[model samples]
Target: MPEQVKLRDGTDTWVLALEPSDRERLVAGFEELSDESRRQRFLAPVSRLSEAMLDHLIDDVDGVDHVALVLFAEGPPHVYDPVAIARIVRYPDLPDAADLAVTVKDDWHGRGVASALLPVVIRRRPEGVTRILTEVASDNPASLAMLRRLGPTKISNTTPGVWDIEVDLTAHDLPQPIPLAVVPPEELDGKRLHPVLDAPGRHALRTRDLICPWLN
Candidate 1:
């Protein structure tokens, strides 16, 4: 099932777990990415996703060791068109952390698509996942900005124009308790729910027992 998410612009988008049947949409979305976007995401200047890579992505949706989610519009004609994807894959040798990656369609850049989708992925963090790590090209300021919104990040420039960032999920304040139901419009008032990206913000709500602190 798809869940409705509210963007900072007050528009609605649907977030769903990627499935094998979504191969066509996923491919189409990746094909639309620009050269720079592709490089920032895959760390390579590739024009197309290989068959093996596509298969690995679609087949790793167990929602445990591998968690992936895609954001898309629900309107007709483009309902299945993926606007962005966020995924976290655990390392067998490094049990306490996972590598994270997020990519938004070029047309949807700067629209908070990644901001909205990231919280969804973080809420679904699997057991034993203490930290999330990602590698970003130094030139990719947009990707870096998105990661900064989560919290204070530990960044290392191991190589020229490449940075590795690590974020400790438990470093933030504990979330305030809220009902695990659809948030009503009245509750959406400024005082009712705090912005998820605000440092030290405590407002949060639950869905299916998963607490999403940054949904608002």
Candidate 2:
């Protein structure tokens, strides 16, 4: 679920929400992102999301409930657009403090975007989310290094060159995090917004997609 939020970073941060209506654009951008050879080397394919799917997800996305942050960077005058960024998705079966999955644009790598977002995520760390988690391809040293800088994280091999890492947010005195807008508000002017929705089995379906056809 996406939410409209304002964040204070000793400065100010405004994050726009990704409502259901933005499904096609969001999914399209995600597809484009995944298509990047650079990103493909590290991650798996992301299945194109449909409007109906988005509706189901957002309808039940309560802030402290099942929420996902779609972060993007902004331009001057507070224009929110794609930010080289990260996101947190909360799963009911998983531990409380949701796990984080981040992707920094190749061009923005090492520019402090990940660092900036981490503290915010830690601050807005959900009430029950004490630990944040993410998976990095074994070969991705840069990501591993950044994760290390964040704090204490448990590492376990998921596959030959893939690993799952969990970061303890409580130990880190991080500031509140806000969702960054990937699309501008003025652009959303008259777009039809759908109720956030997804198939109950879509997650499982995604797993199949990852191993079988493999969206990555």
Candidate 3:
């Protein structure tokens, strides 16, 4: 069964592991991303996801070392709108870590979509994967901030406009697994807001420490 997560705005999103059958929805979701969103995600101009890419993303995925999770909004009769996607693919040479990537629909931005999806991806990570790595454009502050909340992170400027981030999942000190599914938004009341939701519009770049280490 798909897990249901409630967003801060009180809307519900169903989270499920992506399967071969979800190719069409996934393509549609990619098509809906705004141009800027596409650039931020793929780090290049992508007009659309090609057929070969779709086939590889769905059919070629092994679901063990390579896992993909997608979030969908409940829609009218027999339909679901894909709103966000997160994936962790084990590094070919790095045994203890995997590469992480996440993207949320433009309209759904700042609604805590990525925040809800991230933990689910982590919890479902393949066994023995203790670290997560990601590359984000230096201009994309929101993503950097979201990652910092996970744990002690190592950030470095690998290229002029790109940064490499490594997060040690085992070092995260969260007291418990975050609840991704539950009814009644009130049930989440009084609970601490996820870092993504707590400080909207803030960027890690604004805080010098996040990027300064590389300069020293």
Candidate 4:
């Protein structure tokens, strides 16, 4: 079943796991994001999601024992910054513990979209996730303040306009706890180390495919 959270506005925001059915809505929301909003929310430029790209993201979702939550706007998804979209992925590996990402539409900023979305993330922080990491452009004081309110742990300047920050998730101050579980690698075989024995044909295939393409 998909996870969901109800906003204070009496509307419901659904957090669907990364799946094929959810890709269209996700891509549409991402494409609708304005450039300025994209700059503020992301660390880089993000064009609209293509089917292939969506497939790759979904694949990543399955590879990790992590959950990706989509914030719904009255049953629809919303867009965040393009450059910083990876913030969601990095959330799972934070120095502290938390499994949450915050993203807001450009036109929706200062309108409580981020504020409304934060609690949902806090509630969803994994069991042992007592520390959260975030990066905000130094010029973007508003974002820094938002993250600080969650709890000020550490701040380091990455660039003139970017600051990396961390938030601690001690239960005394917060509600949820992150589960202590680590996903292990799927394989550890000699075939992986001794590639020639496992797949001698692969070497010929690579040489034929790449060597001829370069020659042509």
For each candidate, what is the lDDT? 0.61, 0.46, 0.64, 0.44
What total of clashing residue pairs does each candidate reach?
A: 1, 26, 0, 20
Instruction: Identify the runs in model 1 with alpha carbons over 4 angstroms from their true place.
Output: 74-81, 174-216
User: For residues 30-106, what per-residue lDDT tens digits would candidate 3 score against the true structure?
Assistant: 65667777667666666766676665567756778878787886546546677777777766566677767777767
Clashing pairs in 3: none
RMSD of each candidate relative to the true structure = 13.4, 13.5, 13.2, 14.5
What TM-scores do the predictions have?
0.74, 0.59, 0.74, 0.58
Q: Name the 10 consecutive residues with the lowest summed lDDT in model 4.
A: 207-216
Can you tell me which runs of candidate 3 are displaced by over 4 Å? Answer: 74-80, 172-216
| lDDT (Cα, tens digit) per residue for candidate 1, span 1-216 | 677797788667888877667665565656566777766665556666556566566655588888777777543544455577777776555677676777776777787888888888888767798876656777877666666666555566554666666667776763332321333544323331112212241111000101111111
lDDT digits (tens) for residues 106-173 of candidate 2:
44455565566555555555567766555566666666666666665556554455555666655645
Order of candidate numbers by lDDT, starting with the best: 3, 1, 2, 4
Task: State in Å the error of residue 188, model 2.
Answer: 47
> Roughly what TM-score does model 4 have, to 2 decimal places?
0.58
Q: Which pairs clash in model 1? A: 196-214
Candidate of highest lDDT: 3
lDDT of 4 by residue, 113-174 (tens): 55655665565544455665545555666666666567634555544555555666563664
